[model samples]
Target: MSLYFFARSLVYVIFKPLYRIKITGLEHFPKEGAVLLCSNHIDNFDPPVVGITSPRKVHFMAKAEAFKLPILGKLLPDLGAFPVRRGMSDREALRVGLKILKEGNVLGLFPEGTRSRNGELGQGLSGAGFFALRSDALIVPCAIIGPYKAFRSLKVVYGKPVNIDELRARKASADETTELIMKEIQNLLEKNR
Candidate 1:
């Protein structure tokens, strides 16, 4: 936890000025307890940017490759981040995310699974939706409007939380739930764009 806060503080101080990030809807974040941030991926910097901009500690899921570097691997987990295999069914990543939620901490997910090459929305892979359904955590839908647009200050808007009861009634399985959640998240992103 110390390392997480320390790293978070560093990022908050260092890159925030460089990015000139603008964030709204911070009040939607719960003051305490479990929460999930479901965001659209636009660049490799998204996770760290979101983590730093957030007011609370956020456990972000990163590709396994990033963890291969010994120093980064050791530092990342301590800094409230974890690794998930990119192209495989990584049960471990899912378990880690669930554990974070169970512990009443925030879990950050890029529903699209990776950075967008064309700066457009990618298919949300369902991880965020499945996690939300299983953990009964608040899903905070967020969108980054100008991530790929060069040299421009990026705007990240956090939408209102999705009601879990309403989401569960529409789906019988994790995949279905994921699809619905993605659609909801995508709609917000498109509208804001």
Candidate 2:
């Protein structure tokens, strides 16, 4: 197996049981071509949880600070993670994300931009929508529930892919697209709750 797959397997083996992890709606993910996985961020564990559970290899936009660490800096790129500067536009990060999508890979994004400290779904940022529009990739709304507590059941629900062409035809603004994504995520969370 490749290093990325090996690492993901190790993570899944170790954490899945501890968290009682469950994932649903895999049929909604595209079998080929570019796709984006937009999820709500509740904690740092969300990324690995989503990545390991996904049927496809998922490239994530990690913070630039994490890439600065000596060991992780070298390991992250191999594991399909690229760095992005938080709280800034960071055009390079956007470029990397688009490039991954254009190459027909899955890109994992947390539209909220940052973790919600209060366990509440926050407003989404426009980056996810922007990348989807730019790359013409399908956006799959994902909801990750119950990762805040160790030894508790954690659930991940993937909603149906949002139609980028329909949204584009409507002349949807970035904010509008973001809101739509967030609403889908919220709906999934509510259903699971």
lDDT of 2 by residue, 1-193 (tens): 8889999999999888889898899999899989889999998988899989899999999999999999999999999999999998999999999999999999999999999998789999999778867887889999998855678899999999987687788777888888888999999999996
- RMSD in angstroms, candidate 2? 1.1
Each candidate's clash count: 0, 0
Worst 10 residues of 2 by lDDT: 163-172
Cα lDDT, all candidates: 0.80, 0.90
Query: Model 1 off-target regions past 4 Å?
Result: 148-151, 169-171
Worst 10 residues of 1 by lDDT: 144-153
> Which residue pairs in candidate 1 have backbone atoms (N, alpha carbon, C) closer than 3 angstroms, thus clashing?
none
Model 2, position 114: C-alpha lDDT score: 91
lDDT of 2 at 145: 89
What's each prediction's TM-score?
Answer: 0.89, 0.96
Give the CA lDDT, 0 to 100, for residue 162 in model 2: 82
